[model samples]
Target: MRKEHEEFVDSFEGQLPPSIIAEIKDTCPASVTKEQLKEIVELTLGLYKHCRVNAGECVGLVSAESIGEPGTQMTLNTFHFAGVSEMNVTTGLPRIIEIFDAQKEIKTPMMEIYMKPSHNDLEKVKKFAIKIKEVVFGDFGAEYVLNIFEQSMTIKLNKALLSERGLSSKDLAAAVKVKSKGFNMEVGNDFLTFVHKGKPEEIRQLYDLREKMRPVKIDGLKGITQVLPVKRGDEYIILTLGTNLEAIFEYPEVDISRTMSNDIHEVYNVLGIEAARQAVINEVFKVIESQGLNIDIRHIMLVSDIMCITGAVKGITRYGVVSEKASVLARASFETPIKHLISAALESETDRLTSVVENVMINQPVPLGTGLPGLITKLK
Candidate 1:
């Protein structure tokens, strides 16, 4: 670890998390060249200075205008997997709304899973991706056979397909028994059977059992409906359609430091508020960049800070952080002016007219910058 760099970050009085501190130290280790360390230090200091906001800067107005301007240019097109119309991901404007609104469930919740250094090999990553992909019992069954006389069901496995997916008859049998119980299972070379000795009218149970067993997840991470391993630069990274943050973090082969989910709330819940704040900034910038829009990252950061100021994720919407503004007129300006005015009047809420909007509403000069300095004369 680099002692000077560690001390410099620690000077923030634990404002920075240990993982970030460790990452800095690890990257600029004591063994690294002194010139490199100097460059890193200068970059870190420069970033810190760049992030600091001036006192009386109307950050809210700046952020709103910054993001809102480019947001109007976003397309409403959805990204769908060919041949599977139902597996479309919400992108562009809708995706931005899903993030900033702090919606509990997103249309397409996903994760970019980074593997540990040891598991970065192409074959290893490819196998790992398959292992993490959600596998339902229906994948193994070539044909579902239900005998009316025996009141039993059998899943005839396609030997080639089953073997290709790295599944065996025993695995299929175990999964069927675990998911759909009460029937005695018999595993054979290329088939699995479920026999239930029951009354003739209870044959309806056979159809129900088949339906229940078909969708049962026999293996892989639950909620991760699909996984695509793509090689980026030198290493392989897994892109999953559905997110399972809690479960993915538990795997030892996963590089916890780099593994991040697209769902802001999931990131907030799994990681702390700071991580969530960073996610917001990254996600917003990502969308902007995708549309080839050039906006100052600082504006996005300001918005993120406001959303996470209460130490939890809140949206900029009327029901979220915006509604809790200290100034009543600001809230009113956001949404439902009449409702806000009535509520404020009934509650006897005082508006100090300190902020820009409130002062402008009452035809007073806004107290920002030069306006903040009121002239005073001493009695002669």
Candidate 2:
């Protein structure tokens, strides 16, 4: 762009990418002094070069070892909100593995919900959080009772809860009526009853219905059980204990751009593979940082790259990425050597000895950097 910026960039000997240079240039003021630009350029280049690795670093192995070493030091326990919250979320080492493995159903799925600017006020946020928190019949009901003689189930609702949730008994009855029309419903102040059309002698059917109704999402975002609003720097955000990425976005007041689900697969489903890659990196770093441990971010980035390189998130286990290696020997070397060898032999597979693992297995010099040089010459 500017001669001053262009000259400064040229001083790097073409090591810095054009994108980085353009970004620095664009962000700088038009009237910025050449001396300031020079200092910035040098600092940026120095940092970049410092982060760059040597040609034969064997990044994958180094990253695995680096991350794993720290992982052993991590707490294996999950976190629970102290009694009052009545919720538990998987965190620490287990969570780290779950994120890396891209497990379909996470142990403790969670979400960070950001509200639209207009709806971020405390009152609105609180009300919205309440509206989205999963409310089951058991939660608001003071008591759950079975009437075998009448083939009915009745719940005595807490009046204060109804008032607090801005729901009347009629509203509650209407919701159940819509979902379960097979019941003869009666609505009154602080109580509701349902008489199943099925015979009273069908006791097992009634018990099954009781269990089903315990998790009936009356009104709220499904799966979101607890919501806590936290002040982050200058803004407030809601942290939820459960995740339902698809349903939460339906709310018009949610800041769709910023709200995120901690469940990696959910992120992949909603945002695609690239976003899932970022989530893995962010989540790993988050765990390590929280425990007051600092590891090279490059290692974390490399791990994220490997897991996401397949265009879908897969674990670093035998059933996942390890088994999917192009080299037959490479797969064998990971674990269960005989099984892999036998399976490969049955299929008449060939090991080209292309990768480090396969080459090393055959006692050949692994082809990395200098190992790639096949010919030697006399300097005469």
Candidate 3:
């Protein structure tokens, strides 16, 4: 920025946050005179002051109402699969509930895998996508024959499928050997013969081994069941059905900085608390926007801030963010009132009634807005 612009912006440093002032300086046109710039900064400062919450405003309640009211209008549709073959994704109210409750296992964990610029070509991206999808013995198996007379299991492999997956019959035999213990394996041109080494009376073990060996992962990262390489604007990116952020980050061709996962806990584990907080905001906003709700972003931001304030991502449920409340009544009012009351009684806890719910429970005004100030009486 110019020296004059810097000086002008510096004048409003204390009045406004440094970030806001810097934004104003960066946004203002250089053709404008110092007086014009001053006017702009003052106007921005005035708007900022006007938008700020009052000292005693009940922000939590307001945010709750703002988010909760519109939330009821959301659709209850669970899986809105775009196409017959496309992956199913939990959407609308169900997804919102999943997000707020911070469910460890989500219905559908999806990821958008962006590639580095050089590796985003059509063929390369397609190959990368295929390479990342979890391939099992079942995917390559052409035929399975169980011979009870000989107590042996013969598996025929599809050469075309194996070649497409960049695997050979030897790879399949090795996998079967590792997975199916106590079985003598012999690799042929495009087939494997497993002779049961266990007792002949336990012939059922061969059939069991055949079924178990079908799902063993022979190639690609685990948990990635499906991958689709799509052209997004000028770049090609892969959309996956499952999410394994930590495992996926190990790929050199992946653009880790731009990749995103729908699983909030996975994001937290891989990228830390801040990224998880942003993920919450983005996911919530996405649902709200998809449902055509016009709620303000600040309310969502406040909720996200509260969820992430303790240096971890927590849900809005009783066992999560609500459990951290200092007030016993506030915690009780949320859920399991009797349980909270009993616990408080056992601990010999005192309720000062400093907050809203506890004060309301006793028919007293909440310590907010007009009730914030206490009257001082002078004795003669």
Candidate 2, poorest ten consecutive residues by summed lDDT: 371-380
The positional error of residue 341 in candidate 1, measured at the CA in angstroms, is: 6.3
Cα misplacement distance, residue 379 of candidate 3 (Å): 15
Question: lDDT of candidate 1 vs native?
Answer: 0.82
Task: For candidate 2, write residues 1-380 as lDDT tens digits.
Answer: 57857777666657897878777877888777788888888899888888778676687888878888888888987666665356676768898888777778888788999989898788888888888888886677788788878888788998887887888888877666666566777777878887876555676766676666666667777788788887676667888988988998888999999999888888888889999889888888888887777789989888888888889888888888887898988888888989999988999997777778777777889877687544243345
How accurate locally, in lDDT, is each candidate?
Answer: 0.82, 0.81, 0.88
The ten-residue window of minimal lDDT in model 1 covers: 371-380
Task: Quote the positional error of residue 281 for candidate 3 in Å.
Answer: 0.7
Better-scoring candidate (lDDT), 1 or 2 = 1
TM, every model? 0.72, 0.81, 0.89
| Native-to-model Cα distance after best TM-score fit, residue 17 in candidate 1, in Å | 20
Q: Of models 1 and 2, which has the larger TM-score?
A: 2
The TM-score measured for candidate 2 stands at 0.81
What's the residue-level lDDT of 171 in candidate 2?
80
Q: Give the Å shift of residue 379 in candidate 2.
A: 20
What tens digits encode model 3's per-residue C-alpha lDDT throughout 1-380? 57877887898778999889778877877787888887888888889999899878999889989999999899988654455356777889899899988889998899999999999799999999988899988888788888889888788888898888878899888776778788788889898888877666677787788788889888998989988888899999999989999999999999999999999999999999999999999999999998899889999899999989998889999999999998999999999999999999999998888888898999998888888764223345
Model 3: lDDT to the true structure: 0.88
